[model samples]
Target chain A: MALLEVMNVGIAFGGLQAVSQLDIKLEKGHLYGLIGPNGAGKTTVFNLLTGVYRPTEGDIILDEKNITGKSPAKINQAGIARTFQNIRLFGEMSVLDNVKIGLHNQIKYSAFTGIFRLPGFKEKEQEMDYKALKLLKIFDLDTVAQSPASSLPYGKQRKLEIARALATNPKLLLLDEPAAGMNPSESEELMNTIKFVQKEFDVAILLIEHDMNFVMGICEHIYVLEYGRIIAQGNGESIRNNPRVIAAYLGGD
Target chain B: MNAIKNLKPSTCNNLINYGMVLVFYIVVQILVNAGVLNNSMQGMLVPICTYVVLAVSLNLTVGILGELSLGHAGFMSVGAFSGAIFWMISGSQMSPVVGFTLAIMIGGIFAGIFGALIGIPVLRLRGDYLAIVTLAFGEIIKNLLNAIYVGWDSNGFHFSMKDVSALGLDESGEVIVNGAIGITGMPKASTFTAGTILVIITLFVILNLITSRAGRAIMSIRDNRIAAEATGINITKYKLMAFIISASFAGMAGVLYALNFSTLAAKKFDYNTSILVLVFVVLGGIGNIRGSIIAATVLYVLPELLRELQDYRMLIYAVVLIAMMIFNQSPQVLAWRSNFVSKISRSGIAARFIKQKRQSEEV
Candidate 1:
């Protein structure tokens, strides 16, 4: 069974269809790439899978459980965690605290225990601190753990976002343009980190990237979208040779 | 001193806030014992403590939760009335300590209920829409309380919205609440010591909460609702939790405020009161608990302390307000303040003291 299965999912906004007839099957512990032109509904697909938007048609199943139309939090609980294209980090909080927020559901303590500083609260908090630091250490962000999320440089912020997502302990991790604003070297470094995360965390990764070299270098399989529809799906070499993929990017002659 | 300095940043921060309150309490006690405080000065103490608690709780909603609530006073009114009614009903039956504690709890619980009710509907609305709705809710509460009339006798409580005659209470029935007149002849149970203790308790709960799992969740929502939701944080749950906790504290403060005066009026908990608390939160620096305590105390005392200046007092107060705003909000001022604080902590008297202590420890 696939780790994530999107069975003919589609979402329409009134007269316009944002995403239509989208189908994806992600196997466990694999790195997949999603590429598309601007406004090809790549983020819309992410939103649908994460339950930020309920699909107008079709179902989404994660780990063999049908999770379509569930709330974002519930979808996350069902093991689908995603990073935003725009890097929606908790800016004012500490880098360590941001990861701890991801561990919110992982450890349980009531507001009552918190206010009174009960024994369980202290014990759970220490465990959370340890867990959060370990996750931060993975991204080499432990040194700046006390620094605010916004204060970190752009590349570090992206890494922090990924670390935060991984803290949720998901089966399928979605990355929306993980290398959007990075230089080549930075993107290369991010590519390595993403690969490490895939192997180390042992979670399937479905990433949307525009950098062809980065995608071709890391992804085992790639899907090309144009006009909210998958134009082609194949290995990197096959995708590169496909004339339709060329037409969508370089325009047809 | 070294031990305090070596503590975690959050723990050190908590100690500073708690210590500041304790020191202030002790100094005031000394002044009172020395007969340095006038009757008017003494009278202002409990109210100052009340406003401090109000400011801290409001900061939880406005600062930590990142929501502008214009109906904080509405919750306070609910608590004040509910707690006052409890005291009236249980009159002289319980000891003061137990009765007062129960009244505070009752006040907090009632206010918390109102907070949850308002939060469920209004929380769905954001920004100015939320503010406007909360403002309307505050006005509604005040108006509703104005029309309510309640009295009690051996047969139980009688209630009416019309005239007092419509209540149809027996001749022995005593009116606890008389429409716009509100609660009258209520015993004064609030003292400065009690007020200070309540302030300490408020700080403990709020500070502890900020470092807790739930507090992190609430703060994450405040920072980025989209990210928080993506991380599986139950948005509504954390939002309502912050709102209710804030309301409950405000309620307890309200009960303390009401019990200090024999005659308590619903109009006392008006929009102006809510705005007054908001001013303290804003001036204190949002999400800065220590700043809230100082701002609340200083701002509340400034006008009274300047009373001898006559007409110039208002002018001075306005200037002080502007000064505080700049001090709190201006980028240049903030940078300078941080620099100044770092300098003091690193190389000033605090540094020298730590150095001396370290040298002695080595010996």
Candidate 2:
């Protein structure tokens, strides 16, 4: 059975159908891409999948457990984590602290332990610090770990968001426009990093990216979306040649 | 060696603060007991302590945790009435220490339960709507308190305030509170020493909580709810935790206020008190614990300090608040202050000594 299955998911806002009868399935370690032009409902789909917006009608099954309309925190606790299209690091906090927050669910210390400084609390805190440092090192952000997240350059902020999501130890990861503001070289680097994350973390990835080169280079399978509908789903080369995909991107018959 | 050197300044500051608070309280209490200070001055101290505790604790919710709640006064009212009633019934039978302890605990518990109830409904509403709902809830509580009637024992359980006061003291010799007229005769259980101790304890707990992981979770929710949620932090649960804790502290402060004054008035825990506390939090650095405590003390004492101006006291306060808002909000004012300080230090010969010391330490 697939690790995640979305069946006939539909969501609407007022009269606008933001997403309509969308379906997706992913195996444990697949590198999948959801691509489309602006307002193609790619992010809307991400929002639906991550439980940020509940589908008006449909079922989202993860590991044989149905998780429809669960709170976003519940979805994350169930081992699905995501980054925003616009980097949403806790800007006032230090870079390492932002990543540390992602580890919140895993920590075993109670509020009582936290306030009174219990022995187990100290050990758990040390463990969290070590884990946060490890994740920071993976993103090559250890040097600026103590600096406030807002003070980081835009590229580094994006990297920090990814590192923070990874710190949650999610079984499935979703990246929304991960290369939204990157130059070619930076986009190239990010493409390799995404692939590396998929391989090293042994986690399935569902990403929405408009950067064609980055999407085309790293994605094993690509789904093209237009006007809240999936127009085509196939390997990258097939997507590149599809007439509908071409029409969607070029706006022609 | 490097870690110790780095930690030295903060550690020294902490020690100095503790010593100063201890010395100040000791001297103040001695002066008060010696009758050098008037009853009005003593009365002013109660409000100052209560406001300081309320402002500092409310900062946990508003400034650091970043949720706007105006129902804080409601929680304070709950605590005050509950604690005052407890003291009235059992205070004369028990030692002052035990009575004070019971009062604070009752106040905290009452406030905490009400806080959780109010938070469950309102915490789901974020930003402006949340503030409005909480403010409405506070008004509702005030109206509810005004309407509720607990019959007086005398004259076959009379409903009127006149009849309630006629019920006379319990065996404890304290007058039972008459509904909206408030707790008439509470024991003057809180001393300056007790208030000072409570302040110290509160500062310790708040400081420790804010610097801890749970505190950081609360702060992260304030900073970015979506990011915090994606990280598996239950935003509502943490926000409620902040709310309950903030309310509990405010409640404790209310109990302290009642005990200090030997009376409780419903009008005292009105909307204006909540706004006053908010001003204290804002005028001080919002998230800074020390700043809140300092702001509460300064603002509470400012009115009294200008009491010689009599009727103009309130006018002066309004002017000062407006001026402060204008100056604090302007970036140019901050820049000018920084520039002026820099210029002064640069012109002083002591600046060279300090710069040399800093360089030596860096090396």
Candidate 3:
């Protein structure tokens, strides 16, 4: 069974279909990519899958469980984590705290246990500290562990966003424009990080990127969207040769 | 070992904060013990501690939860009246200490329930909307309490609306809450020691909550609501947790306030009262718990210190507040603080203390 399946999911706003008939399926540990030009609703599709906007039409199944219309937090608890097109690190917090919060669902202790510093709370803290640092280490952010998140450079902030999401221990990870603001070399580094995350954490990955080379390079299968619809779906080799994909990208301009 | 090294910075900050609270509490106690603080000055103790609790709790909601709440006074009034009523009925039967303690607890629980009720819908409204809703709630509760009449007679407990005549009691009715008169004949069970203990408990619980998983979830919501949700934090759960917990502490403070006085008035908790607490939080440096304690104590004590200069006291307070706001936000002050901490840490005294602490704990 697929790890996640969005069957005919669609959302509309003021009579405009922002995302429609978005059928997506991800097997365990697979790397899938969603690419579309400006105004093609790639981020909207990510929002739909991650529960930012509930689809007006069909179902979202995670691990064969129907998760349609669940709250964003519930979707995350069901093993789907996502980053944003805009980096959303907890600005005033330490880098480590940014990731520990991502582990909110996993920590097993009550407010009473925390206030009293019960044995379970401390054990959970040590466990969470271990897990958070491990993810930070992978993203090369362990050096600035105590620094405020807002102090990080743009590339580091983007990487930290992904690291924080990884701390959530998701079965599937969604990256919305993770490579948006990076320089060529930075995007290259992000690609390596994405590949490392896919293999190291063994989580299926889905990313929305405008960078053609970056998406095509790392993605096993790519879906091209146009005007809230998936225009084509194939491996990079097939997509590069598809006429419809070319027409959508060009808009026949 | 590497993990321990990584943990050093945040742990040191906590140590400094804990040390500050202990030192402040002890210094005042010593001054009182030495008779350096006069009767009037000593009287400021309970109020100072009460305000400290109030400021810290409000900071949790306004700073940590990143929402403006103007109905804190409403929650406090709920706690104050509820706890006052409990003590008045029970104080005669039990030890004063037990009665007072129970009063605060019951008040906290009641306030927490109100917090949940108001927070469930109010917190869903972002920013200014939350503030306006809470403001309305504060006024509504105050008016409701003013119009409430609780009395007792040989027949049993009697409650009436608007006036005592509605109760149809004979001349034997013991009026507890009269219209606009509020609760009268409140026993002076709120003492300085009790206030101090509550302050410590408030700090311990609130500061610990900040470091816990739940606290981080609340702060994350404050920092980035969307990212907090994306990371699987149930925003509503954490928001209400912070709001209710904060309200409960404020309620405990209200119980202390009622105990410190002879009578209680619903009007004591009004728009101005909420604003005063908010000023303490802002002056204390929003999210800083230690800062709240210091700010509340210093600000509360300032007017007392200038009591001799009664005419000019208000002017001095206004000036000090303006100066504090400027100094608190100054880049130079922030830089100096970082510099001072780093210098002290490099001396290894902090590290040595940590080592000794670790050894003692292991033992």
Report, for all candidates in order, the number of backbone clashes.
Answer: 0, 0, 0
Off by over 4 Å in 1: B1-7, B347-363
Ranking by lDDT: 1, 3, 2
In candidate 2 the C-alpha lDDT for residue B14 amounts to 44
lDDT of 3 by residue, A20-73 (tens): 888988999989999888899998888888888988999999999998998999
Per-residue lDDT tens digits for candidate 2, residues B135-207, read 8887777766665444333333233445445555344343355566766655578777677877787776776
DockQ of each: 0.65, 0.53, 0.79
Tens-place lDDT per residue, model 3, B200-299, is 8898889889988888888999999999999998888899999999999989999999889989989999988898888888888888887788888889
Residue A8, model 3: Cα distance from true site in angstroms: 2.1
Q: Using DockQ, rank the candidates from best to worst.
A: 3, 1, 2
Which docking class does model 3 fall in?
Answer: medium
- lDDT tens digits, residues A91-185, model 2? 98888788888888877677777777778876787687788887887778887877789989999999999999998888899999999888999
- Candidate 2: Cα lDDT at B46: 68
Off by over 4 Å in 2: B1-39, B147-175, B309-363
Winning candidate number (lDDT): 1
Q: Indicate the TM-score of model 1.
A: 0.96
